[model samples]
Target: MSDLPLRSQLAVALGRTASRMSRLAGRGDGSVIGGKIGLKLDPELLTRLSADRKLVLVSATNGKTTTTRLIASAMSGLGEVATNAFGANMPTGHVSALAAAPGARYGVLECDEKYVPLVLRETGANVVLLMNLSRDQMDRAGEIWQLAGKWRKALEGVDTHVVANCDDPLVTWGASTAKRVTWVAVGQHWREDSWCCPECGGPLDREASHWACRQCPFARPKPDWILHGDRVTAPGGRTYDLDLQLPGRANRSNGAMSLAVVSLFGIAPEQALPLLGRVASVAGRYTTVQHEGRDIRLLLAKNPAGWLEAFDVLEPAPGPVALSINAQGPDGRDTSWLWDVDYRVLKGRPVWATGERRLDLAARLEAAEVDFRVVDDIEQAVMAVPPGKLDVIANYTAFQTIRTRYGRAL
Candidate 1:
């Protein structure tokens, strides 16, 4: 039982009641509102809820939600593990999850990068997962290096054992000063943010697998866990061939990092492999939805790095694809990063663009000489495609909107 003050316990009860009310009213997912109310009544809701639990905190610029789902699913074999499976990574989300699952002795949280330190401090998490960091939500996130600096300071003197990606310079620098670290050589495909040293603004030298600053001491740490092709080599020479429903090299990388964490908990990679592989979609990502006679698959990519991975999976599809772009609050106000993606790859493919900023995407596709048409309604644009398995991609808010509409139909 929690040793929290009586006042704090009352606050938690009040917050859970609010969550129920929100859900009943059809306002939205009750997680956010519940968290807000809990924290309002008792600012220490995170600390109280996280008490006496084996906390595993996961944070990164991309893939945190999917990685968290993979980790949580793998942990399910252990027992009832509390997690915010809906992709809410803030303090309130953590509070809501813990409050809902009071019986859970184990907690796995996907934390936002900006709030990682606060969550770490509050929960006193034993293990932290560090994935590669890249440019995301440029207006709110500012520069990527600044976020890395925040991570670096947060890890300093912290007692948690860090599982970090050694292949990415930003991640390396952030996890460098941690009390203890387990480096994993999960490859990084995005290098634009790490072109120069985060420690010292010097030119970085790159080799076949790792990178290092030419003039400074900051260099990539050799990974204790390494991914070679489809196989992952863990400590003590144990190897497991990654078999995941989630496609692409990125998910494989995420699985490798998760395996490294699982090993630390006395669970073998072989035993956890099947559990992680069963996670086909985190929330609505990569979920198949039948809408208006067209079988549409939902794909979400928030940034350039994410877009690169999504394109790799979408390229082989035999039908025309639809893309929705929006600059809403959840999707970030800035959409200039659209220019950085290699849209030329879609040169010969027929593209249907629709969203608040479809014109922006149209401009990019037109400049690349890609054959495309813009439709105002997303559902109609998707349905207008030749009847078959339709491929659809959208930014965060735009994706959520379509997922809500057709997800109900399913």
Candidate 2:
């Protein structure tokens, strides 16, 4: 850091001081505030702090934080790593993460879908991981394909290597302009947002294993990494089983993507699988807490796509499930996406609705013909269920509220 400009050095110092003050004040993890201060002092602090390190940026509508964590953990065998473990995907968070670990040889930063272009331009990243794109926070992010267009323009002449999901047309089209790319066939379960061609604005020909546009040459690329049930086959036809602590097919896809990214760093899948499996929980997602003799698990689902994936990981029927929703700023000031989720799958299971927008959730559940009880308090909702395991699925702010109540703070 001594090699950096004097203004950038002072910015880093002040940012660290502000972060310490924020932690002392018990506000939160000072990632955002610290970076905000740093950027205010020196606008190019992200570029300066990111100098002389191999950087990899992970961006997606979902699973960015978990995939960043997995790639960072697997890269630990090399040396020190800098990363934002929390779900802060903006430039401020990236500045804070890089400033915090000045000596780290490698950096794995999670980037928000909208800020992908800005971060890529600033960081000049060595590798960029493009995961699935879907409709999330519609009030803020207008459409998925529009964002993909921005991504396509950003990668036009960049020298970075891209690792993209081939199953998602939006993601495939986003990485289409990159000079070098490694496609991975990570499954896409939510297909509502990507029903058409991103290139020619025509309908896509869909099949079980492949998809192509009816009006353009755009189609699914031949994948360099393919994900099967619990296994992943690499380029040379070598297969490895994914024994991960994370649950659901969604996480399996995340694992396969992480493996492909780490392989770019010359880390073999054999050496990375165990490290990926050791990650039991990310932030507060998939964490189980024992409260009053009842085991309660936390799952963060912020959109229709996220909710669809959450349902796949819930315990078997008859176990109580709690659904929580909020229209806070962090969660996007809209609840209309609730209707897109098919809650009918929970028809036979005991269901409870809680949070600031309990009525909205209750209404949606009713329309789905799934009987549910509305409980204003999360603890009360959990206690109302029989003393056993209860699963809690919530949006961004609601999940944070429960996590903080359970003594887990991000």
Error of 2 at 244 (Å): 0.4
Model 1 accuracy (lDDT, Cα): 0.87
Candidate 1 residue pairs in clash (backbone atoms < 3 Å) = none
Runs of candidate 1 with Cα error greater than 4 angstroms are: 315-318, 408-410
Report each candidate's C-alpha RMSD, comma-separated, in the order given: 1.5, 0.9
How high is the lDDT of residue 386 in model 1? 71
Write down the TM-score of every candidate: 0.97, 0.99
Tell me the whole-model lDDT of each prediction, alpha carbons only. 0.87, 0.93
lDDT of 2 at 317: 92
**Which residue pairs in candidate 2 collide?**
none
Q: What TM-score does model 1 achieve against the real structure?
A: 0.97
Candidate 2 lDDT over 244-339, as tens digits, reads: 999999999999999999999999999999999899999989999988888999999999889999999999997789999999998999899999
